[model samples]
Target: MFKKLSVLAITFVLLLGCLPMLSAQAAGNATAKQPGNSNPLMDHKLGADPFALTYNGRVYIYMSSDAYVYNSNGTVKDNDFSALNKINVISSADMVNWTDHGAIPVAGANNVNGSAGIAKWASLSWAPSAAVKKINGQDKFFLYFANGASGIGVLTANSPIGPWSDPLGKALVTGSTPGMSGVTWLFDPAVLVDDDGSGYLYAGGGIPNTSDPASIASPKTARVLRLGADMTSIVGSASTIDAPYMFEDSGIHKYGGKYYYSYCFNFSGTHPAAYPAGEIGYMVSNSPMGPFTYTGHFLKNPYTFFGVGGNNHHAVFNFNNQWYVVYHAQTVAKAVLGDGKGYRSPHINKLVHNSNGTIQEVQGDMAGIAQIANLNPYTRVEAETIGWNAGITTERTQAAGGPVSNMNVTNINNGDWVAVGNADFGSSGASSFKANVASATGGGKIEIRLDSATGPLVGTLNVPNTGGAQSWQEVQTTVSNAAGVHRLYLVFTGSGSGNLFNFDYWQFSTGGDGGTTPPPVSKVEAEDMTLSGTYAGKITSPFSGVALYGNDDAAAFNQYYAYGTHNFSVRGASNNSSTARVDLLIGGVNVGSFNFSGTTPSVQTLTNVAHATGNQEVKLVVTTDNGSWDAYVDYIEWSQ
Candidate 1:
């Protein structure tokens, strides 16, 4: 199972049956305040195409899709995809403590729309919408999804939440409308049921049409077609609903005699400088079927409440007479030259329309409003080590047990080392701590112990040193059997006797519930390389030796030599991808790998054990997915 580790503080609050009326002006100015609610009524991550349905007096917000894996250059990061691609439902009766209904509309499940595809960058599923109404006078739930590359599919369930399935292999809209012919990219299907039991499906995110006057040559426009009473097919010519800056996922709401079309504009694409950061915008149409006008940038900013990036891809809906806007954003620093892909988060805020008539993007994060039981034993922190012989200190200052800070080894220091010991973490259990380290220095080793454990011999580990310093290798260990406010110490026991071997910071974890399950290792062979899928050039290792490689500068690569984990030598080869992508595949399945983009590669290891017995066929694949840049594999290894 994929997991997401968030660092925000957690809290809980009981919801009273009241919502404070938001003022339009105040709502627009309601920047996310610091020390905000821990669990705001509705907030999501990497979420898009948000669809909301009020059932049995409770409100459930569903996202059409979300994604966890982030790719840069050619390196892929192992991340939680539960919040993306799969369907997640969060529900609340009092607007607090929303329940996560895991994944619904799961691919390949009974009644689901399509078959699950292989690990493609943007596969699985996309935008989702739900419609609940009386079918033959009995209430039924209709779940709509955009499956595969472009087809709009449908599923049915008895309950609002569902184990929805689509027995038919093809999409209803594909067969119903003649205009949706050939292979086309039309997704994000929003279904609106009319008074007479008929419904219209609004499909969006298509290439610009040049024939129509209203058709702006932008990647945002909706393809509208009415559906028959059975909801099986389209009812008319594929009429295009064009709007000013109106492109991408859109929500259609019928209000006081007019149709309010809320659409998302790639605010990042608005200016040449802002061509990558997306933001939400809105437009209004007197008729859901006609011309719409661009309103304004709903919520466009350079930074997030978490000091990351702004939000985009929104959905707005009404629950019990209250209108709410749902969207996504990233809470991390962004890349200047991205892979043309945007980072996102799911968000919800009460919709406050201006007296003059306009809608704003949701503001004031409610993520701070709720509390959930934390299952993690120890908190994890990511830190950077700079300069030569750098030391990061983390004294036990909090009530809980954890490392005070992290240490990184970026400069070559054959004589440098780390010193770790405990300080004021009031004595608890036999205070157990663990450290995870990575380097390419073959002879690197770690000497660790608690001040209360025993003699100078607490726990010592020697890094397997041999591979080129260009690639990073890793070692994970747990040190225990200590008492009192135990001090855990980490000292690089030099190549032999002195602090001659330098290293990155030793990561410390106290009382962490991190599972002991090791990651799976995928084995690949040199024969697996095909001209189509393989990186252009290759490295022939002389004799029996292991090679390593990554996207790192000479300075960072040189520092690994003093760590004594793997050898500090590395060879560079050409490839392209935002990050350095390392792949080890067994039967074409990726098992061990490391990915790095923009910043220097994180100190980690890709473990492929086939080389241990000298029976492994290794094929290294590099990527140049990003258009402008290229790089090389850092090094290789020979073992037996």
Candidate 2:
């Protein structure tokens, strides 16, 4: 027998260090790329379940802000919560820069209907899907999202973000009803406005952990319900749309004569970091809601040929006729480097439509950039609860944090107030306060008030303390509602110098819809046509616009520059009819403008070209042109 082989202990040590090494290498790779070279037409982390619309030359991104929390690394902090089940609109131009339009109010806190306050599911809002079309004689938007903690609910407003109201406060599609208790009713809504201007909603994808593992393995049982034209209730029996495997965060796209269902599996919806992350795949059907047949996959592990991980929560948005995919990538080394938190940063990639009209993911680039048409208006803010002590007194107080408890600060003299809490109350609701103070002298009292943009004394209360180790006294009061939505403060006022008190909690209950939110819009206007340009070198295949040539000889392979009306292109190849092997740039950034060449010239086309807004510029450069054998392009027309 061969000498016994011992697994080297040294090998184990090396393997242990592999994780840190790999992590460091990954982080370093992201930073090694040329800065500002590979960027998206536009980008942002403000919206989720991104729904986009291009109307009258403007592109708007509609989504829910939900809640604001620190990424584990603590790099980003803000109060941009959708403000109580509200929808937010962000508009952009060039698909690069964006502008936050604020929150689109569907419902606010303490409203007769909708979810708000300290309720379990009321931290922020959830998925919001939007469709814009003309109803009657005027243009209207149908924005749909689930209300309550877990079931499907309906709210309507003429605009994307609005003073939305639910005439019926019950679940539009009941979740886990008596007969359906086998599963937890879930809601991640996606809306489709058909050619007839009729609206149809597709919702489902939540599973109760109580189910047997075996039962969960079967995808056929997963539900996908269809809503009628009104979208107020369900139509036909809830049907299982995605076949073969159950996938959540589903989106629908109709091209040519078929409907494609883009979805992701392995997403648990709760802790986004749950194991087994997910993979992006699609299903195809002849109708909007169908017994979709799972086709091939789209996005998988960008680093490995066979490994698939971290691609979920997706949407298909089109700006100026060009399609793009907005999805969360599991891999975000930037956030990891910045803070060590791993929640993936949002990503948007250009999409290609197959000759048959099916969509494909653009490839080659691992990272892209995004810009906005306008700046997000809300000021980003963060607050942490801290312990407070009254001067020379053994009295200390705990900060009441979160929505349920009213925040308060105490331990001060009369005419003196102190801030005990910090948070941007970005909605309409009642301000709550509670505290107690010990009276150092007779007639000593503690008062509570608010000092905010619209405040000086929101509402006050005089709470008397009976002195000496007395149980904390309660001070209950509600502040006035501010006009629109703005930051709010909770203040504690007390009487008698040197007298201090302790605050318990403070919160604001949103009332009515916070206010209006418009989708991000770009200042640039759509260009009417593409312009001819020159090239100085050999261009990559799958390029757009015109392939410039240094000499009319035309056969030259170098000095080929390509130009296009838009900044989107595929890797190795394209699906539209533009040019290939041309160099393109956006503000000096070399976002890939060409694809690899193989066989025939790859197709390239442009959509949503912006009109020359005085502030922006578009340039195309060519290095070499591959003549005859593989034709190069010069420019494209608006109509292709």
Candidate 3:
């Protein structure tokens, strides 16, 4: 949505087919395998290594979040180790808008962040990739990644964003592993499972693709292994791939019964090719372990359309029978800091293939691919799950606990909002809205808007204080004709103060637009009210108690009563036409202020008083001079 009007308005007449242009003079050509067609997609935070999964009509992307510290010149400072402490998951039905599901927590730990600031495997924590498999009739996700670039580690979880566990309890493939003797550059792990439930792993680096030539070793290899059914260990010995100009970041996949192996290639003089060094090249083979035929360049972004960061890594996935390429670019960091060292983001584009099985030269995109479906808002949706946001950032939900994540977007100041794009309200339409929220201080209002932010106001639910930020409660409000396709915006409006409240999740219902279900409440009479302290000197009984403006601030009410309410009617009257003010006190907190300056001496009502639910002392204190500061309380009552 931040794109220029020219880019936004331009409709691309994309070429729909890829031609197999195999390199005729290629070195190390084995046998031709197959040709193929194939998001910077995220905006909340920067991420790289787009391991894409097309599951149940949705694309779930796993990413390596860059937590780099850059200097004034844009170069990373210190040890760039901390940024890879964790990984994150984002998903989408449509290609343009994506939902950030927060950091993917390691099952037994907090988003890979352990006690203090370190993770169990901090070093090999960069470039993440994963594959989903079904075991025992249920789907399971196997996540593979490099740990500090030293070894390959695997985590197994039931869901993509995990409650995960270290499957092997150590690096699955280490330098100590038999065939991995001189292959020191073992990182950027990619994993995929085939139609028959068989899994494969691709990894290796260090020797040829390093910026520092000294990091290259003698036996630099791009290694592939037949993963066991468990997906944690190798089935047998690893096979070596002798691809011409194959560098780091090996991406492998099976499409149309053909296996495609892709990697980064340098634009060096010795390796003459169409795509430059900072782009990508791929080869194909009939077998999983490729005695492969080197294909020409497939992807090249010599000058990043997103910005200036190198090291091309990518993944190809399909949804609704259409193929796509997901790659990382260093755009946001460079655009923000004037330098893009140690930072990168993800982007996606459609890939079309020729009848001969060769992939089209897929280019990068800015507005990105099309969204296949619309989001539904009548169901319970996670608050931390966002398509896009403004003036807000995600944080730990609380101290990391069992299933409750430490990663929920908090610190929502006034005028801030989060958008859930293209929510389908269905044909019936929605009549109401409900949200789970908590406030440490008091509360605020949630303005529900459809389509654009300043569009129609569907409803406004006034959120009440729920003890603390971690204390959760559900509040409902009414909505109007909120039907059809539109972007759902949860706009927070409070006293422009500091942090207002923490939001959990929200849902719209066809009914219950009449506010929340009523809670048990009772009415207390004036004579039934208890009074504290001795104020007889300035007080007299008209029927009950009356008091003149007190010279002393301490001497006040007779007794205290306990009560709780969101709002209630206070039955009382002011003494005269002069200005009369009183503070309604509850639970050692000033619950409300009532001004009956010009009202007559009749039973009156005060409503919508927001206060906590608990039995506590309720005392009324006189403030300012107004007709001897006297008012009679008949009965205090509330519906909920």
Candidate 4:
């Protein structure tokens, strides 16, 4: 539970506006090509219980990160519930471009405050719901969560991303607590604050041991309780509502003058998977505490249609004058490729209500939501603000000796990239790029590419040895054409056979016309091409920027040419320690060792080499001095 701060209790009043009507065909197909965000808006991690809170102008989605017991396979690793102790909070104004706000501090057993450590909830943190209300003229955000059916807890903060504290240094509801003792699953707590400033807490569900037939037929119930004015304690006795077949994941909200109670249920009759991971069912009542009328069904499981599905939890809210439904699915292929188990990711889609005020069923889409506004590159943008990324991960470490843990891109290697999408640079376009970075093994550069990783290079920020990885330094590079709204990929290049560097944040200046996406280039991946001495592990989407890592001098190999002289270029990074020379070999013979710069990757061209066409294995042998030991290679390309 979180401590209270000053938060003005604000009432949610639906704003009037014209919205695009939803076609019925968009309801059942997970591949539905309608206007919506792609599933797994968060591809880097697994999250569940996606709760949407529209505070002020931005919408923050609070969820349970699957790292607690995360496994790439469909099954939770060792079922270690403690791994789910933390909660992730990501926000977006346009509902498409999300900014990760690190994590919400949920303390575990005997954990210290004012720091980001593990062990917040003893059992685990699952199905958390957050709401911001005005308290004494100031706005305060309240986070409601549970430790995997162990008990229910609360945490409060002045802002969504906060210095959180338990209102009560323990769970607010427990199994031994009066009416709660009868129910086994005392988790998935959902809290709703009515416009009248009244707060309601709903929890308790069925035991998930489906193998034991006796457990399946056990009577199920999801109850609601009136929370105290101080919200830290219960105000009255729990009222058991008839949420038929409601297994768990209870969510409540007030919309269109009606109290909408949404939850996960086993309506399919066949217990498909454990706990019958099925569809989202709803029930409506006139009062927040009511005799709810089950409204049949609204949303189906994406796993059934798209081969990627899991237990579903969701939240519905209106943002930017339009209503949306936010839910989690096993959208990443890591799970669906197997038996359809493992972690879940969040997704958003346009939610339109029927003519009679009943919301219609919705499906997942690739387009996501439309951009709310054009991004002004002139302002500072966090490198963590990623629209699409490959071969990279993030971490929270002390920033440049500062106590504040800033989230930055880690695990950087040759070819890794982060793409910030749809940046609108009006007519004045951008002229330069600046970035704050750190690297233990210094020397590497950021190629400012547009649209794709190998797209048109607009600018290059050459990085100098800034002391170490956590050692922060700002580097700026000039650009010619970088204008308008398009995907910008920051591709990392350098020499080291190991990690390249870390990226903090970046910004662009208005000086030149924006560039356009470059046409595709033809080249073979290192994993598919030749192999030789001192090379590192094969690179993959993990660092989407490149495909391979060269360690030192390699054995010879062949690369084919069209029997005539043609120019060719090399793309890759090198060891951060030195500027080594790599000899371009054709038909297992030496051409010359190209003098590559330090760690950062750069393009080097060799003109007029004649060879026969079919496929020829290209070899890159190292020619290094005592100081310069090795070099890295991404791809060997021939000029058009």
Q: In candidate 4, what are the lDDT values of residues 461-515, reduced to their tens digit?
A: 8988888878888878787677766767788888776668888888776533221
How accurate locally is residue 410 in candidate 4, as Cα lDDT from 0 to 100? Answer: 74
- Per-residue lDDT tens digits of candidate 3, residues 274-353? 53555677788898877767776677752456545456778888766678888876564454446554456677887776
**Candidate 2 segments whose C-alpha is farther than 4 A from its true place:** 1-46, 66-86, 105-124, 176-185, 207-214, 221-226, 267-277, 301-311, 330-344, 356-358, 362-640
Q: Model 1: runs farther than 4 Å from truth? A: 1-46, 64-67, 70-85, 109-123, 181-184, 209-220, 267-277, 295-297, 301-306, 332-344, 360-362, 366-640
In candidate 1, how many Å is residue 397 off? Answer: 38
- Model 4, CA-based lDDT: 0.62
Off by over 4 Å in 3: 1-39, 68-81, 105-112, 116-123, 208-220, 267-270, 398-407, 513-640
- Residue 491 of model 4 has an lDDT of 83
Assess candidate 1 and give its lDDT.
0.41
Candidate RMSDs in Å, in order, are 23.8, 20.7, 24.1, 23.6
| lDDT scores of the candidates, listed in order | 0.41, 0.41, 0.60, 0.62
The deviation in Å at residue 279 for candidate 4 is: 1.0
Best by lDDT: 4
How accurate locally is residue 482 in candidate 2, as Cα lDDT from 0 to 100? Answer: 32
lDDT ranking from best to worst? 4, 3, 1, 2
Q: Candidate 2 local accuracy as lDDT?
A: 0.41
